[model samples]
Structure formats: C-alpha cells, structure tokens
Target: MAFPRNGLTSAAPADTRLKLKIARKWTSAEGIVAIDLTASDGAPLPAFTAGSHIDLFLPGGFTRQYSLRNDPRERHRYAIGVLREPGGRGGSAYVHDRLNVGDLIDTSRPRNAFELDETAPFSLLLAGGIGVTPILAMAYRLSSLGRDFEFHYCARSADRLAFRDEIEASAFAGKVRFHLDDGPEVQRLSLDRLLAYRPAGAHLYACGPSGFLDAVVSRAKPGWPADAVHREYFANAAPKAQSDQPFRITLASTGRSFDVASGRSIVEVLADNGIDIPVSCEQGICGTCVTRVVSGEPDHRDLVLTDRQRADHMTLCCSRALSAELILDL
Candidate 1:
C-alpha cells in the first residue's frame, strides 16, 4: 500500500479495498489459527515488508489489524496468525468461529510501521505470545539475507508457542531461542543479560503484550539509543482517560469548527458535523486517522505515534486538544 511520505493526513478512498479469499486455514498452536489469504482473482497481491499488516474488515462493522507472518520473499499468499480473544470486541471471536476456508473477505493494503533496519550490523528480535507474527517474518527475511540476528521467543508454556514446528525446521534454527514460563528459572529470558551487552550497530525490535513490551523497553532504555529500539503493540497499554475536557477543533481546509464534548472523540464530533475521516481501530492503536496539526497543542492518546510524530500530528480517533482549541489540517 502506497501512502504519502510527507506524513500529512488524507482521507482514504473506498476503492482501495482489496478482496481476498482464504486459501488455507489451520491451527498453528493452542488458541492460535493460521490463515493464508490470496487474491480473489488469483493474481499477484501487493508486496509487503517484514512487519506490514493488513486491516481485515469483518462483520458487524469491525476492523482489526493482523500482522503478516509469511516470508517476504514469497508472493503467492499472505499468512497471518490470529489468537482467538474471547474477551476481545467480537473481531477475534468472529475470525475463529465464523470465518472459514474459501471465504471471501475485504482487507486494506498492507501498511508497515515496524520496519526492519536491514543495514544494521546485528538485530535482536523479541516476541511474546501471539506477538510472534511480525517477528517471525523479520527472522525469515534476516535469515534469507544471511544477516546477523538472534530471535528470542517467549511464551507461557511449550504448547502455547505458535509456529514452533516452523521455527525448528527453519534454516536459521540455530540462531533461535525459546523461553517458556513453566520452564526452569535458568531457562527463562534474562532481560538484564540481554540488554547489558550492546552490540555495535545493533537494533532491537519487540512486539507482544503491553507488560512484556514494557519490560523489554524499560530494561533497554538505560543502554539502547532511542532510535535503535523499535516496537509494535497489538493493543493500547492504558485505558482512555475519563477526565477529557471539552474542546473546539477548527478544520484548516474549510475553516469549519466543531465542538468536541467530554466523553466524545474528535472523530465523532467531525462525523456529526458531516466531516468524514478514515478510521480503522478507534482505540488509537492503528495509524489510520492521523491528521496534521496546524496550531494548538494536542493531548495525544494514541500509541501509534512516536515522540517525533506527536510534535506535529495526532490521531483523530481518540486524541483531544490540550489547548482550548486546535487547528487541524483536515
């Protein structure tokens, strides 16, 4: 999927939707199902990098993002491993219980926020639970390129590890390590030891549950440079704040103003005023509704934006204004 490189906000067109058929589906591990999607016409699908993900549009107006786990070198199909979240908002449950092989579904083009730094001297890839999807793709690319990399996978138990068989059979199996929570203390992952030695020109990437990711990042902060540590979250760490103050937003393009009430989002206010902003995950985890800020400070609540991105842009889905009013480049 091609997007503007200038980091400016623009509405997504309806025609960008792609239809794909489930070519194959099987269980990858306990509570995990691997699904292979191919173009409905049997034509080549768009090429995606290691950490790219496609937004799957499900029934009941649900849109969920899933990381692509297939090897980047392959173009026939895009593979994704989904963990059934019975407690989640219907998306995962629908995917596990309702979706099936040969079913046609709509998805957005692959977008990558967790890109691998191929020029690095060494790479440290970390995964926790079902967060292994993107890391598995990165490992495959690194192995194929013969890059110096180490993949550390952590799970609660041996049976809960997804893609265990694939990792064991991979050509770079020797560079991979597994840590199980039920295993001995010595066999567990030592974050202290892992972050102590900083390999020159090495970059670290991690994806997993919020607590697991926080542990890796907190440990790496004292030793690793800010630019060298990359991470992707499957969900937001903190819940929405209940003390959001009402604010006014002015659209730069049309000079239109809207009043955002407490307990309501900027996007909702815009939509109520006949303005439409393309959005996927309303929880602010995905970067779909990111809009540029022309003036006023924004109280950014999205997990998708980095510190740099927060200076000039804000995700309209959940973010509010820190000032009395905000001017946006809508």
Candidate 2:
C-alpha cells in the first residue's frame, strides 16, 4: 500500500477486509468502552489520519463506523471509544455485551472524511459526549505537532466523560477543559463565551450528536469562516429525502442507463444491475460511496459534504438526483 504521490493507503484486499484481533478492551467511562485492535497477522496496520474511522463488521450482519481515538502516529494498534447507545440499532450493545479481548474481527481499512488541518496556526477542538472520539485523536496529533490548540469537552455529567484520566495525563493537558452539567458553575459550558474568541486563521473542529454539532456550527457562524469550521456528524441530520420521484442515471463508461426507483439508493440500484461501489456508513456520514457527477444537479443529503462539493460529487448511498437524469462518472 505504498503511495508515491498522495499519502494514502489503498483498499485492504480484493475482499475489502482487514482481519484484526482485539489486543485489549476495557471500560473507558460510565457507558463507553475503549477497544484496541491490531493486525491479526502481526504486521503494521495501514496509517490513518487523526479523524479517520474504520467500518467494523460485527455480528448479526451489522456494520458500524467508529472513530480512531489513539494517536495517529501509532500503528501498533487502532484505538476506538464506543459509547453504549441502548437505543441504537444494536452495534454498541453487541460490543459492550459480547465482544471481548483476543476476539478476531473484520473491518475495513481506515477512511477519513474528517481530516485534521495541520497547517492551521491555532485549533479549537470541541466534543460532546462520544463525539470526543475524533477530537481526542486531533488533540493527540496537534499536541505532537506542538500546535497551539484549545480543547473543550462537554458531557451531561462527570461520569459520562470518557478518557478523563488519559486526556488529563497527556502532554497537552493544560490546553483542555472539561465541562459537566453537574460540575461547578465555572465548568459548565457556555457556548457564547467559548466561541467568542476568534483568533485570526484559527480552525475549529467539532464532532458529536446532530444537536450539539448544529449548535456549535450555528454559533460559530458570522464569526468563523465557513471553510475554517469543520465538523463530523455522528448521526445524519437531514431527514429522509421526501421526493419519491424515480430518477435516471447514465454511466459514462459503458453508456448504460438505469432508473433508480424511489426508496432505493443509487448504490442498491447499481448493485442489483451487477455493478458495485464500495460503501460504508450508508447513512452518508462517511464518504465511502462518494461518486463524481459528470453532469446533472444532485439533491445532496449527506452530512459530510459542503454546498460547494455537492456540485461535483454525490454520495450514492443517500444523495439523489434533482434533474430527471444524472450522468455519473462510474
């Protein structure tokens, strides 16, 4: 997986799978579990950026994307923190209840849409609840680069704060602040005051629930440049696209045409026709299924893509075409 140009690794194999063994697993917080996975064959795992996440193929045919929480420079093992979501679609529940150390698991190579900007003069890291997974990695990278950064973590209570001890013990501990709803008055998060300081050319990165990210981005606006504010949403914020009209997609390569019916994604329609596109986190949170749009307007639904990128690419898993027909560079 050597790259002479861009610093990126390729797909795992023809199967698109990386077999790994759980090196360690432990409870990180009240409802969070930290896991470390190493290559099953004992080789160095592929490198990953700070905000990268891998798709974990779990029992019962469930696939979930988990953020890498360990330092990006470490290749001995990949670390991820999972918050037990009783109401989720069962991935976290299986991890907390059945997964154990030494268990062999299947996963995809690391992929990152939430990449860190190492060139920024200053960084503002914000995390709410489990959203800290990516922010924690960013903090590790920033600290290693000796880049100035301020980190703020918010949780409902002190018990829910994940990696409190580990983060505080870090070299950049002095740059971090934790806000708990039940903690002291000064420790409570005040978004207004927290976002008031707008350093020139400073970049802000945030991840968490849709509401939390929405608040942070909405508040940062008019103060921070649109391109300078980066975020990764844990859940898809946009509701299921309401348009039920069927659309046509033309492949630029074979000059083939297919009609994507309502309620079915472009990826599904293509696969049914014996065409497959690599995909993960079908909810549009990950860019695994992003495809270039040769022509036609797209009804973008993904949370990761900006208004600008929507003009050229679309996540086939969720995004659909606005025009009657879309020409895609398949």
Candidate 3:
C-alpha cells in the first residue's frame, strides 16, 4: 500500500448524536405520521445516503430504527414516518401517543443495511405501507440523477398510504404507481407481472412488513439475480429454536470458555463471565450484536444475516451454537 503525497486527507463523519428536536410533525396517513428532526445547536447534520435509517433514543430507554424519508441531499433536517403498531413493544406507541414536536430527542447517525446500487442502468423501488420511507428517499435521489426508475407503493387502502401528497408533487411523479387492495381489481400489485420484467443491469429494492418483503423476495428470486435484489425489514419475529442444546463459547483472544445452558442466551452467559458485547433489540432483529466466528458452526437465528454471511458470523445476542464448542473472534 502506498500513502498519498498529500499526507492522507479524509473526512470523518460529523457528530449526529447531537441534541435533536422535532421541528415539525404532521399526519401523513391514517396510522402513519411524519416528523422532521433538526439539530438543536444549529450545526450541520451528518450526510446520509438513500435507504439509511437512524436510531431514536426514546423515553423508557427504548431505541428504535426509523428510515429517513427526506431528501438525502439536505443536511438541515431528516424526515421519518412512524406507523403505530398496537401490537408493538411500545416504541411506535411512544412516537404516536407521547412523543411530540419541539421535544428534544437523541438519535444516532444514519446507517444503511439496504443500499442503492447507483451504477445500475435501471432500478425498481417497491414500498409496502410505511416501508415507503426509505424508498421515497431513493426516488428523490434517482430523480435528481435523471435516472430511469419506477416506484410502486402497495397498501391495503388509500388511507394506509403515507406520503401520497409528497409523491404526487415530486419530479418523478409520472413514474410512481399506487396499488391499493380496496381499489379496482386491475390496480392491485400483480407480482406475477411485476417480477416478469427484467431490464439489463437493473436492480430491485423492497421494504415493508415481513410478509410483504417475503412476497417480493420469493417472487423475484427466479427472475432477478441475487445481487440485484435488496430488501430491508423493520422488525423480525423469529421463531424459538426447538433443538437448542448446551454449547461452549471460546474467545479467540483469551482462550476463555463459557458454558451456555440451553435455557439461557449467549449474551447472558457472556456478561456473567465479564465479557460484554453491545446488545440492542435482543430479539435478533437488530444487527448490533453480530460477532465473527473463528471456528465451529453457528445455528444462526438472526434476521439480518444472509445465507452467505452466516458462514462466518452470528448474532451473539440471540443466536446459538450448532457445534459443541464454537470459537469467536472476540
């Protein structure tokens, strides 16, 4: 490797963990509402790409991830939509019923698990319900580049559709289509026809509920290349493992080993042994506790890791070991 003659110049990400306040809030749909967040200190916020999400540090010590819906080119404000999930674990309820405009909030810098492939010749963006948040951002970027792209939004009804006004007034308004289940029979999103078309070097992105994303992924699997398809999930309801057994966690650096009981979790056992790994969303939805596997097989139970990525890493917070002894890159 050769160093640059200019003595290595690079830009570090600006601090986004600043004191943030909700500058504005409005109802976007029947159950969804949008909020605009700005730094209270009046400093520029961190730059974010399309499909990025930020962690909201809310009351009751709850942290949740919400996608950025506003234009990525702007640094002054970030917009996100929240769907009140009555069955949720209290995060959405807080945003809908308690959290308010002008209230100071803590937010992490944007992180993207579903990234847009900018070099693609054409793109297809699909959003189901509130999943339109990140997809809308991509639409903004695509329209700015003068690129060829199509945006499809699927919802049970027009009332369930968020950001309809913004979409109608956008530069790519002609490229947008709305699929409502309650509308005409011909208007509902037909996966049979939608997944049948494949443009050369075209990419597809989907986000929404788990069932919605699963439908899109399964339908496009046969036609779209695996690398060309991207999807993101807001929450995961992974089933409990029925075949869990006792296993060993061996730290690679210290050669320390800990016995993990079948009834307990890896994170609990690790913390008892004086080793703490960052943990968030212990339900295996968040990728915060993912750890590298040096040796042994993992009975991967996380929602974030792909089949290829499961070969070397596992989420320590919820995942368990398949082998009797597993070595971790601690």
Candidate 4:
C-alpha cells in the first residue's frame, strides 16, 4: 500500500517491510532500554537522515513509532531508545519486558517529518525526558556537519537522563547542557532566558511532552518567526472534556451521509458503516488519518496538521465537525 505524501502510512510495500534482528539491547537509563537493530543477513540497513523514525510492528497487532537515536552516518545498524510507560497502551512495556537480542522484528522504512534545517545559521535543540531520542540524532548530525548548534536536555533527575554518559563524552559535549528538575532554581531551564535573544536565521526544534513542546513554542512565538520554530509531539495532548456534539458527515465521492454521535469519532462512525480509513496513532499525533475537507468546518483536534493543512484537511480519527455537518472528500 502506498502512503500519502503527507508522511504517515501503515500498509507499506513489500520491500519497505524491512526486517531486522535485534543486535543488542541494554538499559540506557532509569526505565529506559536501548535496542540496536541490524539487517538479519548483516547487510547494510536502509540509510536515514537525522530525525527519521521507523514504525515497529510488534506482536499482538501493536505498531508504534520510535525515533532512530544512533548516528545516522552509520549505516550498519539503527538504535532506538524505549522508555517504559506504565500508563501507556503497552507498546513500551512489551519492548522493555519481552523483546530480546537476536529476535527479529518487522519495521517500516524510515520516515521523517522532523527534519533538521541545514541552512539555519544556528539551531537550538530542546528535549525533555525521553524526547531526547530524535534530538540526539540531530545533535550528532549537526556536529558531524560542523554546524553551529546547542542542545539543552531536560530530565526529572540526572539518573533518569538517557544516554547521559555518551552525550557528555562526545566531541559536542561543550555544546550540550543538562537541566535537571531536581536541581536548584538557577539550574532549571529558563525558557524565557534561553529564547530571549533570537539570532538571525536561527531555528528552534523541540520534542518532549505536549506541555513541554507547548511551552517552548509558546515562548518562541512572540519573538521568533512561526516557520523558525518547529516541534514534534511524542504523545497526544490531553483530551478535552466530554463535550463532543453529534454532527452529520457527507461523503463527497458517494454522496453518502453518516451521523457521528457525541463521544464518537468520524473514523469510528464511517468504519461502522463499511467505510475504511487508514489510521495510525488514533489520538491524532500521527498524520496517517488525514482526509480532505470538501465543505463545512472541522473541529481540528489533531496536533500534526499545520495551519495550512488544517484549512483543507483534517484528521479523521479524533477530529470532529465544528459545523452541524461536514463534507469529506472520502
């Protein structure tokens, strides 16, 4: 299955179903496990740039996205760090508890939406908790390209910091700053101070909890150009209260009508009526379920769609109709 150009896809082509053996696995930090995957036959794996992530197809019909944390320059293997989320839907738990070295797993070809802008005069990287996975890859690529950059890694504690020793020992060690929540007030990250001075042609990239990303973007929005600030959310934003209202949906292709009741989603309603929509990350973080809007206004609950995209398309999984009725391209 070919994925849309929008970047998220589930049914990839056969060749894109890259299977790799877990070459190594070890604890990287508190509640974090780092797994290295290499081609089963020891051939070079697919090449990916910094900030690229692959969809890991785990057992029990679970598919999860994990950022490649290893240096992209190395084509031999891909490394990903998994943080065990006790509250999550069980993907991380399966990775930490069941996966082992020498096991083979299927993965999608690398896809990247959080690409690094090499043209920027300077770059500031902000990471919170396990969000450092992709940012670490960017730091390595930036260092190798001799680009001007600084990385601020924030964690609840020094012990909980993943890849702390590796980062501190790297050549870019001087350019990296560690911020611990348990530290003194002066040592904690000050978003205002860090983003106070916006340099010419500088760009800011952040990933972490939704609140952390929101804080970074919120602070930078007033000073920096909208295009200069970029972020990726590792988790879905908190859901709003149970205020969903029933809405009508019209399929532009077939002129079919469906009713999406309160506490339900467009995808669910359509699927129940024998309509299939490709979807991943039903919480709306991934762009897989985006569909074009022919008419009517959308509630726009997804985090992946940009301002421009939202004008024309909406994520079908979680987003609903703001208007009484919505017409979808289907």
Off by over 4 Å in 1: 1-14, 183-186, 239-242
| Model 1, position 17: C-alpha lDDT score | 83
Per-residue error for 159 in candidate 2, Å, reads 0.6
Give TM per candidate: 0.91, 0.93, 0.89, 0.87
The most accurate candidate by TM-score is: 2
List ranges where model 2 is wrong by over 4 Å.
1-14, 183-186
Tens digit of per-residue lDDT, candidate 1, span 179-259? 988945326899999999889999999999889988999999998987899888877666765459999999899998989
Give per-residue lDDT, candidate 3, residue 201.
92
* Deviation (Å) of 223 in candidate 4: 0.5
For model 4, the superposed segments whose C-alpha errors exceed 4 Å read 1-16, 183-186, 241-243, 251-257, 273-275
Screening candidate 2 with a backbone cut-off below 3 angstroms (N, C-alpha, C), the clashing residue pairs are none
lDDT of 2 by residue, 133-231 (tens): 899999999999999999999998888889999998999899999988785533777888878878988999999888989999989986888888999
Q: How far in Å is the alpha carbon of 251 misplaced in model 3? A: 1.8
Residue 313, candidate 2: Cα error in Å is 1.1
Superposition-based RMSD of candidate 2 using all C-alpha atoms, in angstroms: 5.0
lDDT of 3 by residue, 1-330 (tens): 000011111111125355689999889999888999998987789899998877777667666778898889999998999888877678887888887888998877877666888878899999999889999999999888888999999999888889999899988999999998895533699987999979999999988888988889899988898778888776665576646899999999999899999878888898787776766556565466788999998988777776777889898877898789999999
Local distance difference test, each candidate: 0.84, 0.84, 0.81, 0.83
For all candidates, what are the clash counts?
A: 0, 0, 0, 0
Q: Measured by TM-score, how close is model 4 to the native structure? A: 0.87
Top-down TM-score ranking: 2, 1, 3, 4
